[model samples]
Target: MGLTDTPPPHVPSWVVPASGALLITGAISWDMCYVLMSIRSHRTKSYGMPLLALALNLSWELIYAARVAEHPLERLGFLVWLLLDVPLVYTTLKNAKHEWRHSPLVAENIGAVLTAMVALGCAANYAVADWWLSAPGTGFGDKSGKWWAGREGFDCTELAFWTAGLAQLALGTGCLAMLLVRGHSGGTSYAIWFCRALGTLTGWIGSTSLLWWYWPEAHGFFVNPMGIFLMTTCLACDTAYPFTLAVVRRSERVLSDGRLVSGISVKQSAAPIVKKRL
Candidate 1:
């Protein structure tokens, strides 16, 4: 059934607006982390978000904003996200060459490569959304043989929520892995990670609660094996990220000259070595 066709899920009057506020706050918080990361990258000349994650995130926002027009508030939220992504994407591309200097070819072609990846990601997102809307049992199709072209069957709210959750999981894991491999928080701070984790948690709760209250019949999706696994894995990674950053920071060495070094050899002259003069 279309969104307008079905009355909103019955719940306490306060639930809908409260959940919406939470969702909007989560979106703002998440984008703010990217803003901070972009600023860090500008200062450090190191890219924060992994290329794959950036592509997926940008594409998700663009595709969702374009396809999900039924809900004005939610569509506006997506548009706001797209606007926030502009600076993040710019900083990422600007620092790409410096961040991946090991491969000159990639550094030179980073912009083109990322653009292509985003195009592919948009296509993939569209395909997934279409499948979710038209698929049997899960989709909005009636048993009657006639296919309605302009009519919508599935709820865009649920579709957007699940798609965004999955995308966030992927992006979060990729970012965490990149930070670990670098062994230094060059373009990301603990604050960014903390905000991201909090935002994801809040968004998850808001979106899931709304769905549960409105579409009680589909509540099983939240408790399904795959759903549980995804949620657990995302939360586990987010929770451990702070410790990972802390460990990385501790492992870093500060030279006598006040320069920080990670996984790199420091000369005795550069680092203070206490010597006994007999």
Candidate 2:
């Protein structure tokens, strides 16, 4: 079957609007979080999003946004995300020097490193998209078969959803780790954490619902051991993040100059925690 020739799956009336709401709300919340983070980074010169996360997100938006053109609403959503990412990317690249300020060598070579990261990220995203397109049940086999014609495999949508979920989970985990290590919320805030957590929850629900409705045979992927474990881990991390921030804030002191100081005195500490603009 060709990609466009596949019949649309039968879905119940309510599932469409419910899934749409989840997906749309999740996307908008995430975009707002990124925008807020970018604004904070600009003023504080401290970028919040992890480098790997930024690269992966940018690449995912670029590739999938174009590839899903047949689905007008989904394509438009991706395009909106892509547009929002531009400013965040620019802010990250522009203020990266501050992140590497302590390491002169890294600061000097940051641009080259960022360039390489973007290139590598794009390559990785392409690889995932290719894998999805070539997977067994996506109706792209007629096209994919030209290369590896007869191999048996899993569903494309399952693989793609899993890939994106894992990437988002990793991003959230990495941000949590950074906050813990720094002992202060610099470029991160409660708002970012809250939105990210809620967004991930809704996105997960939305993706799973859509897949279940469209590809009933693939529903097992959600309840399988690996899937359950991954989802649980993501939820655990995201849910705990805000409380963690609150606990850490108890030890934080706002200085006269507006810099945030963690447990240690500013005079004795080598690095003072700069307050992120709310």
Candidate 3:
């Protein structure tokens, strides 16, 4: 009997022992809150885009995790995500223009290209990467054969991963640049600026991971997990900007309403006194 005949041991890592599970669960909960809040307020603008990104991220994460768990059909779900990501990447990039209108020509184009490349490469890599079943202890080993894990499966996969990282960096860098420009222009909100800054830091981590991928010795087992977590946090923070802004706007509206009500009450109280005195 071959080791591949049985399920692999469930060894976990400290970097994110249950991160895959948490990410899947947390994203759903957060997105549900976002949707409920948006619906209750009847405010659709700026909210839907972030929510959409979160949805896509969660969906792909689920597929990836399932594959790790050795689910046969999960590979098909990944392919589906790869296809769906094309339009999603476009949407994310398009929205950046509005968010960072003050961004320079280079920054703006970088953001656009980065979004597109990441989407394309991520989809392509999962579709073609041979490591899916070839790696030691993978459950798919039993069902998969050497034919499916040939050298061709390894071909340019690293390139695809690097391309995805570059795209993420470009978008994150652009967002940070836009925030700086906003600060200089005195027009950007603090929450949005903070989000971009967080993204920039995570983007750096992801970029570093790519650099590590090129070198065999420096590839710490934790590198991939750390990089993945950082990027996910970055994206989650970015998507949260809209919700933060919405909460601020809601607060301002409530304050305005209170002031108006007070003013009306004061005028009515004074009017009766004046009429009686006259």
By lDDT rank, best first, the candidates go: 1, 2, 3
lDDT of each: 0.70, 0.65, 0.36
Minimal lDDT window, size 10, model 2: 140-149
* Candidate 2 global lDDT: 0.65
* Best candidate, lDDT: 1
Give the per-residue lDDT of model 2 (tens digit) for 16-134. Answer: 45655777788788878887887766655567887777777777677666653345566777778888877787877676675566677767776677668767877887787686665
Task: Kindly report which residue pairs in candidate 3 clash with one another.
Answer: none
Clashes of each: 0, 0, 0
Scored by Cα lDDT, where does model 1 land?
0.70
Q: Judged by lDDT relative to the true structure, which candidate is superior, 1 or 3?
A: 1
lDDT of 1 at 185: 75
The top-ranked prediction according to TM-score is: 1
Instruction: Rate residue 163 of model 1 by lDDT.
Output: 73
The TM-score-based order of candidates, best leading, equals 1, 2, 3
Alpha carbon lDDT of residue 10, candidate 2? 58
**Candidate 1 local lDDT, residue 184:** 71
lDDT of 1 by residue, 186-274 (tens): 77888888878878877765556664665555444666666677778788888888888898887865445433347644456776778
